[model samples]
Target: MSVTPHVVPGQYREVSDANGRVYRVGETDRSLLGRPRAWMVWLPWIAMMGVSVYEYGYSSAEAVLEHAHGWTLTETFWIASIWAVFQAGVAFPAGRLRETGVLPARTAMLAGAVFSGLGFLALSHLSNPYVVIAGYSVLGGTGAGLVYATCINMVGKWYPDNKGARTGFVNGGFAYGTLPLIFVFNYWFHPSNYKMVLDLIALGMVLVVAFCGMFFRDPPKSWWPHDVDPLNRGVSEDARRVAKRLAKNPPAKGQFTPMEAIRTGQLPLMWFALVCIGGVSLFGINFQVPFAKSLGFGPLVAASSAGVLAVVNGVGRAIVGWLSDYLGRRQTLGLVLVVAGLAQFGVLWSGQAHNEPLFLIFAFLNGFGGGAFYPLFAALTPDYFGENNNAQNYGLVYSAKLVGGVGGGGVAAGVVAAWGYAGAYYLAGGIAFLSALITVFLRQPGAPRRSGDGSPVAEVGGRTPSPAEATT
Candidate 1:
């Protein structure tokens, strides 16, 4: 006897052959995509990316202050380092809240946005270093942490099948969003009246957050696309039938609980990969402006250069995401890491040469690696672990990056203080290479399975089930 999957009004039903392992009759709904809910979930993703850009802009503003206002290098490093630490501190709690469904994802994101906007607003007023620390470092940092954790978590849940692509796109948004701000700040502010510049940045952040809030929403239980299938292939027909019946009765409830995932081994490996990439990438991103200044670029040039890196970062993410969809996630990542390591070395060499064009080229290459690394990890994690606990797992992984940023930023600053800019860039490059080396140890979670005829089925289930499945 052979069984076919079918969809019914309230439940899924399937029959088994005499050999229980083979399903003879099954009802599987095919409408997981093309639902109103999928688009709804995507809104927050785009918004989160936008907010990430705002954060980069905020940090860039600090670089401007360091150069124009004569703020010490220690002052700049302390502010940025504290901000990253605050982000790390809040990550786990926010993830827990998301996992428990204590707050709607959009609400959390909006709250974070408001805090971020306010931080910039407050920053515009303060002249003292302590005030800058209080506003941007503590308050602003806290807000960024909350917003980032919520946004990435939501994306992971919404696009389980294409976790790599979806997460890459969202993460890419952060790098890309910086482009507009780069132009905006360059046009809006000059060193003569830096206070006015702060006010404008604050105002801009307010507008950006408000615009994002309009569209952000949590995906409904039934919001998946129609074509994608669930990856849990071994789920028995009876279990699926029971789940369908339950889903129909309480249509908004999730089938899997978060606690179940925390108990699994996959979460640890996923967390490890995320942290490793984040650690290396943040080290570069947070220090780019300072690194440029050390190389004899003035404040405006340094800030502009940082913006240029942001552009390359965005492009790298888009390319890597596209490739991840075609090539396997692990394979693409392995190759990217290797290339990133070499780029880091180039940056170190270019800094020693003191050639502006070489510095720009190396910066682009290094930024490309940094930009590509995170999104790939974002996509890969969901591939290994189920989406149910994505927020929690990603939050934990991000912490590693935050920790790395704290150390890396301070170390980069110290290197500049002692040996000059070339030494700092060299050190950063060495660290990136070390991170690339670690990628060699990554293995795809499962061995490939073959059909009776020995054909290979591509890996699926890293993203969310489509709309058709939810309705069925």
Candidate 2:
């Protein structure tokens, strides 16, 4: 049973497994050097780290940016909110182009690198709020979005056989890579040298992304590990182990186009849940440090708390991702949201009591849940919708963050001004709980969406089709 690809120049070829099932293959991992490449993982991973500072890394620097630019809290938040809009907005279009081969992975990375530099520069040199918003939010957001979407998609494509652990590892970088940067902003950063520091960071983004982007690429359609027998492990123990783990979470029956996925109705459900989850996360990112300060905590404690958030946020993504492989994506997601939602109350209590240790502990959990949901959705989109159009499907889901970002930043500011931190935290907790409740309804799209009585929706025929039924 030797499996071979029938290469028909310029079009998708065919490959059949031992089961006699046929697969359509597009561009594959075949390179001059070999079949498998480790750099495929490391490069996209490093590129994720490069663009990460754009979103998750901004809180510690927010105060300095506010002071350096002579802006009020509302104005500063507006800038951040706008950045979120553009960052999440660009994902689908950028991903569409990337998938169509109009914008290759390497090209997207290079462009993102340059845009990221100019975004930081906009803050350093521009004085007008309007000017800063356009320069940083539009340009920087798009740049970072392009890089972020590309990196996450790459992992899903490359590791289709086991997306959980790897996708989580890469996504974790987006949260924690700014670990050293957080400390820098805290201990050494000042208004006088802010411009110099930003310029350096801008340059660093270029160098790091450029280096990694050069190696980035996507796997062909219906691609699986070349040596692993997905249907039958035969005598290869490694393949057996790999296949066994992946058996729990199988790929979509077929590659779905973006429009087709939308028709399935899962995308909108994901969008709404993310809107709530992302808002809570971003609110924590933007206001948690300031909240600590408002409680009369020392600057060191404030900075340390933010740092703990970042480290735990990043580490939790990896841990949860690995955990999802065993627990399943939906279960892991529900747990994460529950923890995050409850932690908001803990954080609020710690602040009221001015309990430093309690605040730090809850901060760690907050960070953990804040970032974990992202990779879950990232992994889930392809799982439900199929991997071929993952970029577009995921882009639609990720775009919810724009709404969340606005609510978290500017809207949260208003919440603070109105009902105070207690009200805001209570609201955030409730949102997280709602998001968890939503996760409970998530079923494989092609499967029947269940009713309150546990009866299947008539059209879905009651369950996920077996892989055999899914295959054309």
Best by lDDT: 2
lDDT of 2 by residue, 324-371 (tens): 877788889999999999989999998899999999999999999899
Give the range where candidate 2 is weakest over 10 consecutive residues by summed lDDT.
453-462
List the candidates' TM-scores in order: 0.75, 0.89
lDDT values, one for every candidate: 0.59, 0.80
Q: How many residue pairs clash in each candidate?
A: 37, 0
- Residue-level error in angstroms, candidate 1, position 110: 1.7
TM-score of 1: 0.75
After superposing candidate 1 on the true structure, give the runs of residues whose Cα lies further than 4 Å from its correct spot: 1-42, 53-55, 67-70, 184-188, 219-224, 231-279, 297-304, 444-472
